[model samples]
Structure formats: structure tokens, C-alpha cells
Target: MSDAASRLAEVETNIAEAARRAGRKAGDVCLIAVSKTHDADAIRPLIAAGQRHFGENRVQEAAAKWPALRGEAPDVTLHLIGQLQSNKAEEAVALFDAIHSVDRSSLVQALAKACDKLGKRPQLFVQVNIGDEEQKGGCAVADLAALLAEAKAAGLAIDGLMAIPPADVEPAPYFALLDELAERHGLPLRSMGMSGDYEKAVMLGATHVRVGTALFGARD
Candidate 1:
């Protein structure tokens, strides 16, 4: 098998094992192969390997490659996993099947407007600044309820909560915290973990794990 396909299979195995550890079925967890900064050539192999869900960090970058890639694999689902600027909401809505970073009220409003104008509503995840890190793009933990309320009031459907724990630290607590928050708010999905920590995240009830490096190797 090709290297990329081999890597994809291993990651799937890991995800299945982790899901089993968590007493959950593997099919219940969505493995989102984060394809940010990679071109179509890099992504096609995984698609051929049956990886239907992928993620990108920017709307323009995703637009540059995914249109053609999806043309080849119409079953592929694209997710916007990076922080989104309000002005890019229209383009992001048009391009991605799901968005994992709806973190603030203004962006929520912009997305609502875009969805209304375009007549398409992608699955939305309200990001929580679970670590309260200033450099991050998520809404403050204290602000989460308010932000989610604003999103609902704007007529946007919030599918779940997404978060990145403070880097270089043990992520279990943060993953557990995100799980608690999701349960508290009755959200069914939790988008947490990257390649480094996805197993822990799945064990902690993550419905979606944004895996990149493990599937694609280190970025250039």
C-alpha cells in the first residue's frame, strides 16, 4: 500500500482501539483528517483510502484545491477547522460542509447572514476557550453560554462544542472539561484533540477528532 494510505489505516486502527477503550463504537467517532497546508496530491491518497472527511484551516486555501478534489471525490466532506474571519463567512459557508470554529457572536452573525443569503447551513460547532488562552480563537469558558445563546438567537444551529487545550500540557483534563461542558449544554458533539492527543480525546467522549500530523506526517 502507499505510504499515505498506510498511515491512514494505522490512524483508523488507533481510533478504533481508543473508541473501544471508551466503551464506544468506532463508527460513533468521526476522524477528521486535517489537510491544512497540503495540496490535492497529498490528500487524494487518503480519499482513495476511504477517508471521506477532511479539514482545512483557511477558506481561500480550501477553495484553491478542494473544488477540484471534491469534483473527483464528490463523497468527500470538507470541514473548516481554523479560526474564521467574519468577512470570509460567505466563502467559508459555500465551501465547507461543516465549520468547527464558531467562537464569537459577530462571526456567528456573519455566518447566519451568509447562510441566509446562500441558502446553505453547514454544521456548526461553538468553540470554547477551554484553557482561557489569550492567543487562542475560542470564546472564553465564561463566555461560552452567552456565545451559544447568541448563536441560537441568530438562528444558527450549533451541532457541538470544539476546543484545543493549552499545548504541551496533559490534555486529559481539558478534554474532560470540554466533555462536561458539552453535556451541561446538551450538545451531542465534542470536537477536540489533534494527532498528538486524539486517543485521549476519544476516550473522553470526543465525537470528532481533528487529526493531521498522524495521518499526513509533519507539515513542511
Candidate 2:
């Protein structure tokens, strides 16, 4: 098997083991290959191995890579999983299938405006600062309800909530909180977890896990 395929198999094994430990079916979790820094050459093998969804962090990087990668891996679905600047909102809406880091009203407004111009609206997830960490770029937990109401009012399709628990704490409670918030708001698709804590996320009912290092080895 090719190197990337081997790595993908290993990741699938880990994900399956995680699901088994969580008493959930492996198919319940979706593994989004975090291809932020990596290029098309690095991701092609995963595509060949049947990975259809990939995530990128930067607008410029995605813009640079998608044209070439899309032609090669026509079935791949791209997700923008990073903090998006308003100036780049139009390009991001054009390039990504979903935006998982809508943290502020301004960003949402930009996306709405961009969508209006494009005549297409990509799925959106509000990023929640469940840990209340000041450094993170997410709406404060107290603000989520109002924000979700605003997003709905703005004609945005609120797919779910995305979060990154404080790096220093256990992620389970935080993830569960996000799931609760999503439920309260009548939203589905909890996009949480990473290589380190994805199993806990699954146990807490994460529909989508953003796995990076476990699938790609270590990043530089």
C-alpha cells in the first residue's frame, strides 16, 4: 500500500477502536482529513483510499490548492475549518463546502453578503468558546443562543456548533456542553474533537471529528 494509504488505514483502525470503546458504531463518526499545511501531493493517496472529505485552515492555501486538487480528486469535499477574515469571506464561500469557524456577527454578515453574490450558501457552524478561554476565537458560551437566533434570521443555514476545548482541560465536558447547546438550538452536526481527544468526543456524541496528526502523523 502507498504511504498515505497505510497511514489512513492506521487512522481508521484507531477511529474504530475509539468507537468500540465508546460503544458506538465506527460509521457514526466522520473523519475529516485536516489538510491545512499539506498540499495536493500529500493528500492524493488519501483520496485514492476513499477519503472524500478534507479540511483546510487558510483561505489562501485552499485557493492555491483546490483548483489543482479538485481536478484530480473530483469527489473530495473541502471544508474551511479556521478563523475566517471578513475580507476573505467571499473567496472562502466560493472555495469551501462548509465553514466551521463562524465566531462573530461580522463574519456571518460577510458570509451572507458573499453568498448573496455567489448565489450559493455553504453550510455554517458557529464556533463556541466553551472553555471561556480569552485566547480562542469563538463566541462566548453565553452569547451562543442569541447568535444562533441571529444566524437563523440572517438566512444562514446553521448546520451545528464547532469548538476547541481549552488545551489544558479534559475535552469531554466541554464537548458535551457544545452538544447540549446544539440540541437546545435545534441544530445538528457537532463538529468537535481532534487526534488527541476524538474518542471522548465520539462518546459525547460528535457527528464529525477533525482528525489531523493521527491521520497525517505529526505536523511541522
Name the top TM-score candidate.
1
Clashes of each: 0, 0
Alpha carbon lDDT of residue 66, candidate 1?
93
Model 1 TM-score, 2 decimals: 0.98
- The weakest ten consecutive residues by lDDT in model 1 span 139-148
Give the C-alpha miss distance for residue 106 in model 2, angstroms.
0.7
**Candidate 1's error at 129, in angstroms?**
0.8
lDDT (0-100) at residue 105 of candidate 2?
A: 90
How does each model score on TM-score?
Answer: 0.98, 0.95
lDDT of each: 0.94, 0.88
Tally clashes: model 2.
0
> Per-residue lDDT for 99-215 in model 1, tens only?
999998889999999999999999999989899888999988889899888988989999999999998999999999999999999999999999999999999999999999999
Residue 42 in candidate 1, Cα distance off native in Å: 0.7
